[model samples]
Target: MKATTMKTLTVSLTPHQAAMMQGAVESGGYASNSEIVRDALRLWEQREEIRQMELARLKRAYDEGMASGEGREVSADTLLKELKAEARSSG
Candidate 1:
């Protein structure tokens, strides 16, 4: 992927967060705090992408149910009995 534009900005962190990033760099696990931050941003981006996908799935399911025409009325007990019978047959 083409490199995105970079910006330099100062950020404040709690002592523990600052120490964790510093320790990573000192241990040679990361080149610098900026590298650690960038890696973290990538993970945040992926998590957001997955979150959006789940929301889309839910929306689609809702639309499908809405478009399924009139619903039939069934008692909870009757529905549960049928569901149990279906599960047993499938199993």
Candidate 2:
């Protein structure tokens, strides 16, 4: 196993945030404040990765939609009327 070098960082937090971390340690769920901060960072990193992936997926979908056909402008009323007509005819 490879040894990883750890760096110490100083972070300033609000009283509420500080209390929350202290509570977690007191609850025995976490060994120390560092563990809580590391866990929170891991969750934050995961959420950021997911957000980037979703944005990329949306971009691809948008590109595909734009490439599918020519765009047309239609009012809500016109669209509703057209849809109703089509439904009536199909029925």
Candidate 3:
């Protein structure tokens, strides 16, 4: 097993937040406030990673759409009629 170095930092929290952390420890759900903070940080990191992936996927889609070429304007009635005709033929 690899040995990990730990660093300590002071953090200030609101009264409600402090009570919530303390309650979590008292409830036996967490061993200490630091553990709760570490767990919360892990969740936050996961969420950030997912958000980044979604942004990249959207960017790729936008690039593909732009590469497909310019779009033409079509009238709604004409488009609808054409769609209905195609559907009828396919069906």
Among these predicted structures, which one has the highest TM-score?
1
Clashes of each: 0, 0, 0
Off by over 4 Å in 3: 74-91
User: Could you tell me the TM-score of candidate 2?
Assistant: 0.81
lDDT of 1 by residue, 1-91 (tens): 8999989989999999999999999999999999999999999999999999999999999999999999999999999999999999999
**TM-score for each of the candidates:** 0.82, 0.81, 0.79
lDDT for each residue of candidate 2 in 1-91, tens digit (9 for 90 to 100): 9998989999999999999999999999999999999999999999999999999999999999999999899999999999999999999
**Can you rank all candidates by TM-score, best first?**
1, 2, 3
Give a tens-digit lDDT track for model 3, residues 7-90: 999999999999999999999999999999999999999999999999999999999999999988999999999999999999
Pairs with steric clashes in candidate 2: none
Q: All candidates' lDDT scores?
A: 0.97, 0.97, 0.97
User: Candidate 1: TM-score?
Assistant: 0.82
List ranges where model 2 is wrong by over 4 Å. 78-91
